[model samples]
Target: MARMLEISKLTIRNFFCLREFEISFQNRGLVLISGPNGSGKSSIYEAILWCLFNRTARQSRVDDVVNDIVKKDCQVIIDGYLNGKPLKVSRFRKHSVAGNDLVVVYDGENFKGSPSEIQLQLEKLVRADFNQFLLISSFIPERIRTFAAATPAQRLAILGGILDLHHFDMAYEYTRSRLKQYQVELASLEKEISVIERNLEGIKADIDYLERNKAKKKEEAEEEKHQLVLEKRRLIYRIKQVQKELERFQKGKAVDYEAEERKLKEERNELSSKLTQINGKLHSLRQQYHDLQQIEAKDYIGKPCPVCERPISKNLVHRLMQDHKRKMSVVSRQIKTAEEEKEEIENRINELQKRIEYLATEKLSQEKARIQYENELSNLRDKLSFVQNKIDSIEKDISTYDNLLKKRYKDLKKNRKEIDKLIEKQNELNHKIELYEIIKEMFGKKGIRFEYIRQVLQKLEEETQKILYVLSSSKLDLEIEVNNKEEIEIKVYRTGIKKRYEDCSSGEKHRIECALAFGLNRMARSFHLMSTNFLFLDELFDRALDVEGQEKVFEILQQMEREIETVFVVSHRPELQSQFSNVVVMRG
Candidate 1:
């Protein structure tokens, strides 16, 4: 059911040209607002918009919307009802800093809330927002036949928004996005699956290689054990030979290898000290260069040094930059020299390390030979038993290679397990991708909902043409044709002569606008897009109209007035007021 709007009072204070104005809209049937220019009739609509939306169509800047001549607070109030409920809306901007810039109070039924909450409740009641109200409910000044004269594509766009057809577009886009996301996920999974498969293959190859070489490794371990026995025997023989050679050492002096190593170490330490001193000097020079660069970067900050407290010339700045450059160059050279010296010292240390290792090896061998010489001379049986113990240790190492091979098998088993999991996930993603493809097909532009949109467009055209036939006095037939993509073109046949909407006369165009407005409003209600009980014409009939055109418009208005709950017409023609059941007169 369409809710009736009854304005018991409208108050405007210091807003636009309305210093302090109030009006009552309690009467019914054909409300006529007749006023001259600058009489603030239009401001009434502005006040309504403000009181409803906390905004006005007069300007975008709310702060400047107040009357400059008044230099005070601006306010407008529209007290009315929605569906038999008592509703009073008060919209005001304050005169003091303590108050708000815009205040909205909506008292309807049992709900009392803030402006935003009130607006939501209002949209629930009226079934439209501020912009939707202007499009479907209000017929404002200077836009009588505008919608019908617009291009067909442009018409579709406007109708689409009010009809909420963009929701279909949004749904289709959402489906497509999901489709892309699934496809990408599936592709990523496939790549990951491939990587796992490749890793699995590598593991299998390694296992196969290990299996193939297992026997070979066992054979090699046997051979290595035999070679180790030979090495042990050779060592035993060499020990006997070295014992005989060390008999000379027993008769000779003991050379101090440790003392010789210490002498080489002292030389390395002195060279390292020189290198450290050179590096330290280089570091200090580099730091000074960096400080100079930092100072030069902000050379404009001061003319002289803060420590010296003396004015310095530009020449001095240049000299300082040159000195910094020279210092950097010197530091670079010093770094190179220090690095070279360190490298030379490191090389000497490495030479000493090799010599020390060789000396230690020789000393160990000679000491062992000396010990063997003493032991064999004392007891040969104990020395032979020690060599036999050494041979048992080598055999234990050969047996451990089997454990290493088992570890390789364990790794292969782990890789295969991971591969199996990846394949399972891949299969699941593949099925999901298939389902997404079907979903994409269903939501594509030419898919399931496309025909529904076409049907709605067809209904709109039919309703518009039906209204046009009823409103227009001429023998006019309207047809709207569109391509598959929903591009529309309006073709009018007047006495079998065809013409576009742009080619129509002003009277014919006005009739088309009236038809479209009524049809669109009907469609809006039929589709439950938005709901409104009022239609307004703000200076819509003020344009130049001949007698016949005026009569046709009056007929259309009368027909529309009966269909709608309330129709407010703002005009300058007072004679037309007699045609209306209710009249409002405004005086400047």
Candidate 2:
């Protein structure tokens, strides 16, 4: 929409060797202002900026900017139309012994009102002080070259200002600040993860130790169970042994006590019968001897001769007496034998009685011994039974202990397995975290990531290629590409063969710069929704062009003018001056 900018009038007083000067600009075409060095041609440009914005292009101070050619009281005026609207701006610089004083006026309105009102209106219109926008000279090819030679940050600033992308620059700075904050947060997260992982490792170690301790306890419990079983077995064996001894004692087969008592009683009874028979025989023999003593043998023999009186021969009487004497002797011997037999029988009976008494005493003792053995055997059997029961109970307790130990061991093994799985998972998470850190660091070192900058670079390249085609007169084709490292490189082609940008000539570089500028202009128009009614070309075709190159440049400019409303060119070259429809010359 800003199709025409015309300077209707400009007046300079005491400014840069131009004590008084006047200039006017054409509305729709190129206007050339040219002279030799120090011809006040540059001073005209300075006065135009000083009247509009009240500052110099060289960034000079206020006192120094007061022109040396002006008298003590001097002023400059600039009247123009921006977008067909009237604009009038003026500045006055008064010289004093102490310093120079400055005053400003805008659109016939004086800045003598409240300072608050002036600041508010100025901030609303420009967003910067009016003194900072002034220029004393045209920033042509030399200035562009100077800007290109500066650092990348300075170049970027200039490019940003030209493209009206200061907002984008500010946004980029904000993004960088946020990226730093993210990096700090990521560092904190990494530290926290490290601490957690360390603690996990420590917990794993503790689990391992606890598992080992559990295993030891289980082993000890198993040993105790085994010992208990062994003790129970020993108790069973002792009980069995005692039981066998008790059974043997109950049988009573080791002593033949009843048979010995029967034999002693039979011998005593036989001795008593023999003693009674001997006593009876001795009584009969004693009675026979007493009858013989009553017979009175001597007196009876003499009376037998007187009483008998029959056949009394001396031989017969003597034979009868002899018979009687034989009888008496027999009876006496019988009596003696009977008495001795009876005496022997009495002594045998006494001995047999003593033996019977001794046998009875021994039988009583054997009975008492049997009773004591039976009682002891009963007690032993009871003790053996009790021991056996204790062994059984111990065996059951040992079995229960074994079961518990096995269960505990199984649980411990399970816990150990789970711990191993956790350790493996923790290691995997740690590796993932490390990979993320590496990627984050790589992204941080570059200005921006591929995803964010790729589209912008692609658009730049396409636009640059289109401009290159226009500048090259369709004879040479060029393509601009950005490599993975984010460096911009150009590729050229002739006859459908590609060539590197560095391999091109100086003329090629000039062409490339023009194409790139045009590309930027096109981008601005597209972004701002501007009507392409005019194209402004400064001294871009001055340095690296021959006659043929200039002709080509003129051809392109002519083609653009035909398609658009107007084309303006400012140049000192005679060829360019002759190409224009109108010309105005300045002389000093």
Candidate 3:
């Protein structure tokens, strides 16, 4: 059941070369839109395209669609009915301002949405995209061969959108993506498993090596510890012996050599002082004796008085002489006594020096002995510390052997468990990889999508042949084939003689193009399950068609008029205008 799209009216203002054109498409049948060059015949349908989709086939830019004379304010309005509901589309651009100013009134209610949103709603209302309208519903002379001439990828993309096969593409991409992810995960797990296996092998070797050497290592540790103990005992005994020696050297009564030397020095100084005093007294006594001898040798009695420079009496002189002799005798006795005292003081000082020298020698010998004993004791203490450290290290080594083996066994068990888990995870990832690989193949372009294209081509071939039969004078048949390469091949057969599209004559190509357009329209109507009442043909019968060829094309349109509500055909031949009752002529 195909719903009908009945376009009632189209209004155009300042669009392209139209410049305020209006036409009523309601209740029309096989109408002729005859016009000379640049008379706005194509602009009429261009305006309708712009109103519905914000697009025109003639222009790339929206501003270019505005009429050159008017220079601004391009508007196109289309009033139509979709499934018996009123649908109105209005598109306006006042000098390209307000950004795609578009509105759609559907079922007598204004639909609120952006231009693109409303466009989507309109497309859904018609059950087709703009490409579908341009390719199937509207037949333009310049674009009639678009589907047949498109590259393989371009054709697939266009066909894919019209057929609504985006889900198949999505499924293919998603499955391939999941497959790749699973493969990467599986690779990582394989690498992890490899590392775990290597680690397990290493652990097994380590456990075996440890088991083989455990008893021997323990025996060696014990033997080493016993030797260290013996060495420690020997060091302790030597340290004790050195300590005794140090104590023995330290216990002697220490003599105060400095005090003894000080006392002896003081006594020697006192004796020397006494001797110096005795020598001084003897020297004075000698001087007095010499003076008395000199006085006796000289006759001072007859000389002037030595003290006063006056003549002196003999009796006075003789008394003075006697006094001098007595003084001399006293000085001689004093000199003898002083000499004896000086000799005694000298002997006492010599004894004190000898005693001080003896004390210094004894002090030096005792200091040397004390330093030797202290050095030996220090050396013994250092050796004892070293031996004690060795003993402690050996004991620690002996204690750790059992614990070391136990830890190795524990690590081996832990690594084995980890390897098992990794293997299990690796298995799980492998299963996922297999599943996704199958899923990827199922959704690929050569899989289910291939079948879909095959079915479409089959239906397309049938429809094209039916229309191509009426358009071709040589009983031409159209065959659209989808090969394994996913390439579409459109072939024309004339009584079983096949020919490529490009090999056809110009007039033949045009007829083929016309039939292909109608065939696609029929296919689209079937696919959408909707009847699109409007069909536009721009200069389909104007060129490359002789009189009989032209009549054949017109006959197809007349047959379509029975089913379609409006069929507007643009032509330059004035003779064909007489064949249609409803005709709109554009004179430029």
* Candidate 1 vs. true structure, TM-score: 0.59
Provide backbone clash counts, one per model: 0, 2, 0
* Ranked by lDDT, top first: 3, 1, 2
lDDT of 1 by residue, 1-588 (tens): 655455667888877777888876554557888878877777777788777776776655766657768767777777766666666766666654424333433443444566578667766766666766666667653343545666777766766666666777787788778878877887887788788778777767876776667667667767766776676676667667756666676665235655665776677677667767766765775676566556562473356677687876677777877776787777677667766776776777778778877777877877787786776644544545554554454454444445656776787778677768767777877787788677666666566556665676578778877767765664788876556576656788887799887888876776677666666666656665444456667765645456765676677677777777667788877778777778878785
Whose TM-score is greatest here?
1
Tens digits of lDDT, candidate 3, 152-217: 666666677767778788998898888888888888888888887888788778768776676677
C-alpha RMSD between model 2 and the true structure: 22.2
Model 3: runs farther than 4 Å from truth? 1-6, 81-86, 95-100, 106-127, 146-171, 186-435, 528-531
CA lDDT of every candidate: 0.68, 0.56, 0.77
Where does the lowest 10-residue lDDT sum fall in candidate 3?
A: 246-255
What CA root-mean-square deviation does each model show from the true structure?
A: 37.1, 22.2, 9.9
lDDT of 2 by residue, 173-289 (tens): 565555556556656655665665566566566656656665665566567656666765665566566556646645653344456556656765676677667667677777777
TM-score of each: 0.59, 0.42, 0.56
Worst 10 residues of 2 by lDDT: 128-137
Report the candidate with higher TM-score, 2 versus 3. 3
